[model samples]
Target: MYIHHSDVQVVFMFTERFIRYIQFEKRYSPHTVSAYQSDLDQFTGFLNNPQKLSPPPPPVITHPSQITHYHIRNWMVELMNQHIIARSINRKIATLRKYFKFLLQEGVIEINPASKINTPKIPKNLPVIVEDVKLTQMLDDNEVFGTDFKGLRDKLVIEMLFGTGMRLSELMGVKDSDINEYEGTIKVLGKRNKERIIPVNNELKLLIAEYQELKKKQDFFGNNSLTLIVTDKGANAYAKLIYLIVQKYLSYISTQNKRSPHVLRHTFATSLLNRGADLNAIKELLGHANLSATQIYTHNSVERLKSIYKQAHPKA
Candidate 1:
């Protein structure tokens, strides 16, 4: 199949414009924009070379307009054959749907080929959460997390995530100025650059103050950057470091199969709901875009209630 240079250029131009729109106009995070770009790249790769093992030349689609529903279906089928999970495939499909939607709105295409495609049904897996008692015990145990700078930082990282229900990205983005000590609130820049103020308890505020003091004692190098968390070298803390910190502490407390910062976030929300905190309040604290996202924690709360009833009720 012959592909024209101009045709490929046209597709590239549309993709570029769409990326710009999402990044600047829509205010999507860099991570999200990269995921969308990756999905498109994978789709284009499939169109260019559909058959990896079998060597009969595959159908070539040089332009986005040339992409049809059949092409999308084939791509999805191939993705399934490669053992990609339904959730990931659905995300890729969503990316394509958004891209085609953009093209349709911009008058580049008369019809959106990805419009009619069905998203794969994903299994409803409840999020993992640490028990409140276990977490509190762990936090209170100074021997577990020592008095050193790294130890204090790690402890604060866990507390901030669980206390505020902030996402890892949001926690990392937190600056010194974002924390209002007097107001007892920390400002978090959430997804799509949305800012929300989450109230911090007195204990958490003191922990922040202690961390800041310890941070100053170190050879801190983040002169211009106001990031709250920093590396041992005094640079900004990366995701992997935070993940390892959460994983290490969580392993000591809970035997859950999954232990990460997100699990701490789940613990935060579930603890709130178990204690009768309003769903909308949890949503705002977590900086969730919608109430539906916050509603998932209710399942954990319900499960906990069921377990309590089963244990304590007269009728088994």
Candidate 2:
């Protein structure tokens, strides 16, 4: 039974129902749902467009059979030629594959056209990593002990990023209770809301302890305080706020590429791997869903080998 134009709520209702089904019934993680939501929103928006679907289109697509492979292919092409990154294009395709699989199992469609579509081939680019010396200087560059509270907040922010090697989202989501001084670890919620405990360096532990002391004196860590890193106003840190802090500190050193919170993460992974840290341990630390996703760091090791070979070769 196809959803009709007259039933606006039916379309909305089914979308929510299907999403919930995937979340609970199918055991999809929250991170997985976030990605699926982004893809489906775009997909449904395309189908609802007056130019794409015929005039007086139905609000909800009731029948899974109504979707065709042609539509899926067209979406892929649009993402490709329109300059979307191949990796991102592939991710959107994966989202469709999972959604259509659900529709097939539910008997909504006789065939899964999305399954037939090919994923775009993504090229691997060199991972953006910062030099250890530059990162060292950037972390220690916080001499700006201005009189205002914001200066103290900013100094702590940069130090945490370099110390923890956490993603911007992960850092922003951290809460006060997540820090365990006795354990010398911070509980970080990673992609898909997966939780991992990362050990804190002595410097970071001491710094956070000092900050906590200040926070107590100022009465900032009050009940209902949700964020771990806060602004001078004692609110949660946003992604943009993290970006601005990274930009300011990274400017103090000679970095070749753009410096963002993610670069700090890549730097952390590469630095650890270069220092002989186990790949499996690094994978867990980074919270990668698959080992293949973490395998890109191997390329950096290969590049390092080449650099050393060229420098030491007496004949060359």
Candidate 3:
């Protein structure tokens, strides 16, 4: 890839340094680091051929200093021409901004070229939430989930997601030591390695206890596994398996176009907000970095109010 660049060595060297900085100093997750790396690769590919065709291309972008607002604008137009959504384009823009900022800090560039670029505005779509009645019926129906280990585990997985509003990664990371059975609270390791304690009600606590007992009877759990949730073979639960578990059960109860573990998370937040839970409290429980990220749930509350008003008002 460097052979295509005019100042290949400089750009190549600085890009590696930036990757290391984010991985070590910034403590970014692997998934996030991969995204940043992909963005840089895409930009470099664009620079190699602004027209995006094979060989016989224009002059390559060899150094960070060669990038300008005009180049950034052209890249945005190309992405738009390919029908990339505004949200994804905005993310790519953010990646460029961060990369250029890092270059400026390291003295690789005099001015940040991406600093002047504007992010495309994205529409706010309300999160999909499972209705309380449907969720209640599904959880209460033992005939469907059954009394077996897999059945019980699947049921608890759905309940835990809805009950705690925890992310799938957080749920997968839970350990026996993280659950304080006596205090009725579970420690959640959220994004950016931040930890928070979410209180579990008696019902959830009981379900967890039942699952634990069932786990002990099974020979699948080896001595080394400390993860709270495990597969039938006693191996650690993976993201896809958990996703399938949630998807299968939600399919039985919801007619909504989208149904996943995240919908349960949305249900948890919207349920609490509809019942008058404080926005700040929900933010803390969800382990959000800021209140703004938690504010989207308020839109659901407003829509609920509109529905109630339409039903109660007799002006028609």
**Model number with the top lDDT:** 1
RMSD after CA superposition, every candidate: 2.8, 3.9, 3.5
Worst 10 residues of 2 by lDDT: 50-59
Ranking by TM-score: 1, 3, 2
Which residue pairs overlap in candidate 1's backbone? none
| TM per candidate | 0.89, 0.82, 0.83
User: Which pairs clash inside model 2?
Assistant: 3-62, 31-192
Tens digit per residue, CA lDDT, model 3, 137-185: 8898889899999999999999899999999878988987898999999
Global local distance difference test of model 2: 0.74
lDDT of 1 by residue, 1-316 (tens): 3446676677789999999999999988766888999999888767666453233333554667777787788888899999999999999999999999999999999999998899789898888888889999989999999999999999999999988999988888898889899999999889878989999999999999999988887857345547999987788888889999999999998887799899989989999999999999888888888998888888898898999999999995
| Residue 43 lDDT (model 1) | 80
Candidate 1: segments with Cα more than 4 A from true spot:
1-10, 52-59, 219-222
Give me the candidate number with maximum TM-score: 1
Angstrom error at residue 206, model 3:
2.3
lDDT of 3 at 248: 95
How much lDDT does candidate 3 score?
Answer: 0.86
Give a tens-digit lDDT track for model 2, residues 90-203.
898887887778777877667888878888777888788778776676556556444346666676676677667777778887787899999999998876557899988988
Candidate 3 stretches with Cα past 4 Å from truth are 1-16, 53-58, 216-226
